[model samples]
Target: MEALNLLESFVRSAEAGSFSAAARRLGITPAAVSKNVARLESQLGVRLFQRSTRQVTLTDSGEQFFQQVSGPFSTLRDAFASASQDAGKPAGVLKVSLALAFGREYLVPLLGEFLARYPAIVPDWHFENRPVDLIQDGFDAAIGGGIELTEGVVARELVNTHIIVTASPAYMKGRPVPAHPDDLAVLDGIVRRSGPTGRLRAYTLRNQAGDEAQVAQCTRMVFDDPEAMAHAAMLGYGVALLPTTHAAKWLESGALMRLLPGWHADNGPVSVYYPSKKLLPPKTRVFIDFVVDAFRDREFAARFGAP
Candidate 1:
């Protein structure tokens, strides 16, 4: 099939009367728009535009091609719009990947209300610790911190993410609580191993005043997932640095307490990502909006300590 982007470039350039104008409409550079139109011209073996120093005007062959392509293209666009309207009803298996602990603690609970609103949408959520190839793996969306941005994938920021060193009351009993980063050197540490990198994750702890210090790990055990590390700390394993989203509930319940209340490890934003912005199916779109609203309602960015 012919590249639709090439056709878009040609048609947009034709309508807008300039490559720069077309580029603005298409969210690309003028050079890129010109290049796409040029490629399309090469593929069709016809000169499409008469380019002057100031502006571009369609050639006779280009005008004829546009006339032939425009009507059917308009109809196709209308058909797509109609189909998109139908897709808006939210009836499909909504496959999404999410961080394990956050999903279990936060997102999974929101499903009842979400499903009540969009009954046709099935929640096929995959919760894991590491990032997945959202495009190659056919995932509808992914929610987590530190997701790498890629072409055609759009990430909407949901909340700020941070890691805090915490331990259970039982574990902290009779043990001197760490007063500083250097104090952690004497404490038994539960460290996390990155699934993708296979390296022990070390965090630079920071205070509200922007002072930074490297955490010294005296690891008694290594866990891959945040929940695992948190569990280990609760089981009296050691003090663990964990995402505040995962540790928040426990901290509230007294299962975990902050080691240094002033300091936290910033992990950047937790975002909900989809493949593209154009013509999103209803299920994925609603979930993205729903999660954003939920996080807003809770003011999760501030609650998670990265705000």
Candidate 2:
């Protein structure tokens, strides 16, 4: 049990990046965290971290050790959490991170139902448009589009997403609708700046002959925020490219019209991801199950349409 405690302390401290931060998270003293890590290192005869006045960094040996131990530790943590489920209702905080627009437009409503179903569990949620390191941040789970899974994390597909090109009816009122991808050269184009690389992406449209071709050069407006780009498109500022899920309401309302509908690319998948473990906590398990069910429901499919 002492060994288990030390291992848990060491893992949490490594993940959190600081003894003080880990101690606060574990409801223990910084000295206790430091002592446990020291004892763990002594037991293994290996130094885990190089400590400094401002920060702590893992040694090469420590990184290899952590990779080996993290999997089993996750399993043990999950098994322990699962065992506690039979004692009573799940009662703890669940930390989650998600895309801001998706969280506000879809997940927020979904969570309302989840909260009602499990009142004993509390959630601490963070929404952002940028990528985050879930393990480093101590997040239990994350819901996102295009999340790349790495070692120590498990990713489950929740839904398929489609990309769509659209323009406002106002913009179409005077301008000739683009009959081909090449026609976009004369029309105003709105582009999204890639979050990771900050590069502008332009879509290629397919011809009736099924030959792929790039859109022609046009006056381009770039925006980092998807919501802002969509709004600008709605105001007839330019042609906007966005996920089908985000543009669904506007398409239904006839405020925006899909352009080159047959040429859009599939945006891959939206998924819920968490640390890979042998057994998930009851609350987290229930949440994952709920999201899967919600996405699979026929009614839900009707709203988002076929991917």
Question: Best-fitting candidate, measured by TM-score?
Answer: 2
| Model 1 quality (TM-score) | 0.71
Alpha-carbon local distance difference test for all models:
0.83, 0.79
lDDT of 1 by residue, 1-307 (tens): 3487788789878877899878865679999999999999999999999998789999999999999996565456434543755444766678899888788888988999999998878788998877876755557899987778887688999988788989888889999988889899888999999988899998999888988999998988888888888888888888999988888888888888888988988778889998874556667778899999989997876778742
Pairs with backbone N, CA or C atoms under 3 Å apart (clashes), candidate 2: none
Q: After TM-score superposition, what is the CA distance of residue 179 in candidate 2 from its true location, in Å?
A: 1.1
TM-score of each: 0.71, 0.84
Any residue pairs clashing in model 1, and if so which?
Answer: none
Q: After superposition, how far is residue 159 of candidate 1 from its true place, in Å?
A: 0.7
- Give the lowest summed-lDDT range of ten residues in model 2: 298-307
Error of 2 at 155 (Å): 2.1
| Each candidate's clash count | 0, 0
Worst 10 residues of 1 by lDDT: 73-82
